[model samples]
Target chain A: MSLTAANIAAKPKPAATEGNGCQRFNTMPGNGAQPKTNYCASCAAHDKALCSRLTGSDLAEFGSMSQHKTITAGQMLFSEYDDARYYYTVISGDVRLSRMLDDGRRQITGFKSTGDFIGLGTDGHFTADAEAINEVVVCQFTVPTLNQSLEEYSVVQGRLMEMMQEEVINLQNHMLLLGRKTPMEKIANFLVERAKKYSGVDLDGDAITEVDVKLPMSRTDVADFLGLTIETVSRTITKLRKNGVIALETAQHIVIKDIEELELIANGEA
Target chain B: MSLTAANIAAKPKPAATEGNGCQRFNTMPGNGAQPKTNYCASCAAHDKALCSRLTGSDLAEFGSMSQHKTITAGQMLFSEYDDARYYYTVISGDVRLSRMLDDGRRQITGFKSTGDFIGLGTDGHFTADAEAINEVVVCQFTVPTLNQSLEEYSVVQGRLMEMMQEEVINLQNHMLLLGRKTPMEKIANFLVERAKKYSGVDLDGDAITEVDVKLPMSRTDVADFLGLTIETVSRTITKLRKNGVIALETAQHIVIKDIEELELIANGEA
Candidate 1:
């Protein structure tokens, strides 16, 4: 379906707190009746955030400057050309960062999951749109506050730099995938990466054997991320399954039956 | 041509000093006849590197940690799977950063020009190979020395973080181009970006007219960088020229005749 501001506005709005140092704007009136507190110590991403580098009062100070936000699936957290007021860190679920051409062609730049940082553009305006692929929770802080915290905490600044470098590396690898990898190779690489990122190890005796990977994004999203059509993505998955390299547990789950073989295909050795 | 380690090692080596607080390894035997000193203050990228943020003793200390080297065209600066011991910043000319699959498919991730930083991978091993597209000069520094300098100078750390963020942004834009843009749109975007980056404005009676953009990399390199075939790249350039949107002064240089129209095509609005 085509995305428009008016259509997006008609969806369910996120519920946020309005008073006691936390102010939230509801996209739909009376939608945010269930108020929530913006506490960082109890946050899921607290350990992965820059605030984790802080100690005692410093952590409390950072918590006071941050807010917790929950956005529903298909809801846009922000759009292209919007003024970037707050930096974000994903706490749960998935967020798709994308840019759409005027003719409606969309490129998914990234699928940000737990612990991934967002909205750190150098320019005042965002160059891409960010939407929730599932129910997503994020920690938000103003740019000024983030900068002040960075100046006050060197470790925090160092961590932020490290994350940005990680982002550069991730994007570079994606470029290789989109520019060179064949359809099957792209699918293999995607599965391998997802398994490494979000898989649970299944131990057979003292040695680890397999992993269970959950894919939150749809096949269409995968096609967009891999720079292929939906038909190509589906065909490749069927071929891999036929080749006995992978097993489908459900629509949004996969089991890497032959990981070594998958790795060979991913590296283009097969 | 297929790139192999032996072929790359057979190219002309980069000249470097062997002793006197600097050690440089020659990639090929009997290839370096000229030796050079490690002088950061007199370097061309002095105002662009991380050392530019240093002052007085800090500047001198950073200078002691950096080495300047000139690499000839077609020579590999560093290859994939090599140890990423040093970070580099281009002082002059262009460098191509690319990765090749085991089956020989290669993708050019970026073309690093003057003031662009390279070799900032997080893992110990380099993920892509960097080669000098032309005779190029670069400033190199070890990671340990860079970290020590960061400890001594917060501004240097901040500046490094900013550059990394810029790299992330650049790669994200390229992701959109590779994944979504049509061939015409891709070429249009590439030209517009290059013009903005390297163009010199010619003013006719203060009215501000045409822009002169230099294309240092070859057509094949541009094709690989844009994820298109060489034939498609050449044909698109010819089409643009015939359409009166751009004029070719030489094979390696272009004048954006109608930048406004080019911008519209780049955004896919035309």
Candidate 2:
């Protein structure tokens, strides 16, 4: 059976346990404590997100139309075939976008983090399922509201187009990774890519032996994303650690000991 | 070692022969033909392409900015790392968008046909290489020209955004096919998808015993696109034919004898 939101809600909630290696958190309703004035203008992701192009009255207008939403780990933001009524901009945390076959085999298409936009579907229904990987806060806008605003703000429209173009590029890169890369290369590429997401870090800090990399998603999620088994994922990580390419700070954190080496491996040159 | 435009140009041009199972045609220079008025409005792809939304003066302006060119099968339309100067809309034939690793491993990300847009790059450089699968005709426009047109025509801008969103959806579907689907399922899905591309075909004609489907791309291109080896692709096609699901009219044409059976195989239910 398909894992719809209603199906998930109907099922008995699993215990909030860490033993299974799958992280879980309880869903909470909105607190309604957010600031009313110029929310988009003051957003932390404003400069980096599609909203950054908006200014003055346009930015304020977007803020008025947007609602802040928080989703706990394991809570689905939307499911396949869900009505495409909302557009989302990730404020914080990661959201895993996946699709499942009839037999329940899943493929994680993407992991959206800060400043990433979601729910830009052509058809009225979502083609994939999106679930919160951790505590995720997003600025949500109703489709009609966003489309009206886009009509008024050319800059906002341009930014949205640019964002979509970037999404296409990202998807193409991931396609290559999925279609051609080896398992070791996939892991290395994933790590390097995840590192790049955390911009402003000293990526070329040769003196620094290890740089801590946060991995909010579990190994299973990583495996699904990379089209590998969980055992393969674990084994590859362990092999990288043994080779001094990476170090495990925790189950959810990795330390890149050799960025150059990882790059070489990712490019299949090592 | 990279297959850059320079490398392609440096290599000796293959003879324009069809006997090799690949059609090679010479790249023709742009010619200022007759009937300059109402170019976009009178375009054959106007109803199908993004230009359909444009009207009157906007259409005329766009037509003035676009140049039509034909590229042979072996010609490179654009290469990875090339400057993103022009945007193209395929008027006829197919183009393969691909990326290659430094070690020469290639991944076919997409195959664009009639009315499909190309070169919507996020950065100033193209992320993938585009080559004509056969003799192809395309309408090309400079990036600045298209951006200027988009600013003037909101309909054009909206259409572009819609196209990008559709591209994201397509990429997600392909990701599932690459990462999750079995080899047989992949081939089945590919055939079904290719059949759908041919508009006006009797896709569901219960009375029709078989329907012809054209495949402009070679088996090797198909294998690369589906993440399978050529031998595996051949074997899978043979199996489908032996099962009475399809018949090969030629290496490039497939006749679907049982659409229901193909659908079942595509869904992994058969």
Q: Which candidate ranks first by TM-score, i.e. highest?
A: 2
List iRMS for all predictions. 10.4, 8.9
Which window of ten consecutive residues has the lowest lDDT sum in model 2 chain B? B1-10
Kindly give the stretch of ten consecutive residues in candidate 1 chain B with the minimal lDDT sum.
B1-10
The C-alpha RMSD of each candidate to the native structure, in angstroms, is: 9.3, 8.4
**What C-alpha lDDT do the candidate models reach, one value each?**
0.73, 0.76
Task: Return the lDDT, model 2, position B257.
Answer: 89
Please compute DockQ, using alpha carbons, for every candidate against the native two-chain complex: 0.32, 0.31
Per residue, candidate 1 scores C-alpha lDDT tens digits across A167-265 of 666888899898878899999999988877777453223434356778899999999899999999999999998988888999789888877778789
The native-contact fraction of candidate 2 is 0.51
lDDT of 1 by residue, B1-270 (tens): 000111111222243322222334223134255322224455566676666666666676666667767788988888876755677788888999998877777889888877778866455556688989989877677767666776777667666665665666678889988988889999999998888767745322353346777898999899889999999999999999999999999989988888878879988999
What is the lDDT, from 0 to 100, of the residue A16 in candidate 1? 31
Query: Which residue pairs does candidate 2 place in steric collision?
Result: none
